[model samples]
Target: MNTRSLLHHFKEMKHYFIVVVLVFGFSFYLGWANSASFSHFLKDQLAGLETVSKTLSNKENPQVWFFIFIFLNNAIKSILIIFAGLLLGVWPLFMLVANGMILGYVLSLQTNENTLSIVMKGILPHGIIEIPVILIACAYGLKLGMLVWKMGVQLLVPPERRTASVEMKRILHLTKPLIVGMVVLLLIAAIIESTLTYWLVHL
Candidate 1:
């Protein structure tokens, strides 16, 4: 998309972005306040993920393989979140909250003096790009959910009054460029995460 179109799209989606941010903050608060209780629950929820993370962190895969893995993993997640918007946005919101809570819980666990530095080194390299991309995906998902709701509402009106097709076309128009941008950002994020992040953390 051109700069103007991109800017307009961002403005149009601002409310959805804010919703995700608010939910994230709330989830973080819950995780921080109930860390003792939530920790156990989150542990159970994330057991498989933890195992995979550990394996990845330990293995010294070639950069190309690591990039491919990271990119595909992120791409699938983004697609799932976007598609989940069809469920009236609940799925995307739930996923965002879950992820936020997990992040908060994990952060709460790091109590050592070097924790801040370690976390920064590990996250900052890729997080600056990845986090925003994920948020944008979630925002678009929420927008899609809203569009679906609007379409359903339009169906209740007379055939001449219905605008579902028009809405669908608008959605597709906005989504195509957003998805392309997200893929490009994710590619950069994966490269940074696999290389720069690794080096910084190991240093």
Candidate 2:
């Protein structure tokens, strides 16, 4: 899609993005206020995530390998989120909330000033780019879900008035640029996280 069309798509989907952002904030607050209970409830799932986090935290991996790992991990996540949107958008919403809660719980576990500093250093460098990209991806997922819903609604209208095909085309048009943009952004984020962020944290 051209720049104008891309911009229009983003503008049209602003409300969906806002909804995801609100849901994320609400989930974060819930996690922060009830971290112990929430953590206990999700202990099994969290354990696996913790293991992966620890592995990624180590600086021993070569930059290229680390970059590849990060990029692939994020790319897979983005794709999954978009696909989940096909399920009436429920999965994307759940993923957003789960991620926000996890972030809040992790931040809450930092008990000391030194630990907080270390965590911030490790996250902030690449997080500035990575987090926003993730949010945008979720927003796009929600948009797809909305499109699915619209298509369903249109199917009920008279054949002459129905515009399902047009909606489908619009969805594809928006999705193409969104996927491309997200991939490029994630690649940049992976490079920053693997190289610069790692160096900063270790220093």
Query: For each candidate, what is the lDDT?
Result: 0.80, 0.80
Scored by lDDT, model 2 comes in at 0.80
Which candidate achieves the best TM-score against the true structure? Answer: 1
TM-score of each: 0.87, 0.87
Estimate the lDDT of model 1: 0.80
How well is each residue in 116-187 modelled by candidate 1, as lDDT tens digits? 885689777898898888888888788878878988888889888877667666766777777788899999
Candidate 1 segments exceeding 4 Å error: 1-4, 57-65
Q: Where does candidate 2 stray beyond 4 Å?
A: 53-62, 112-119
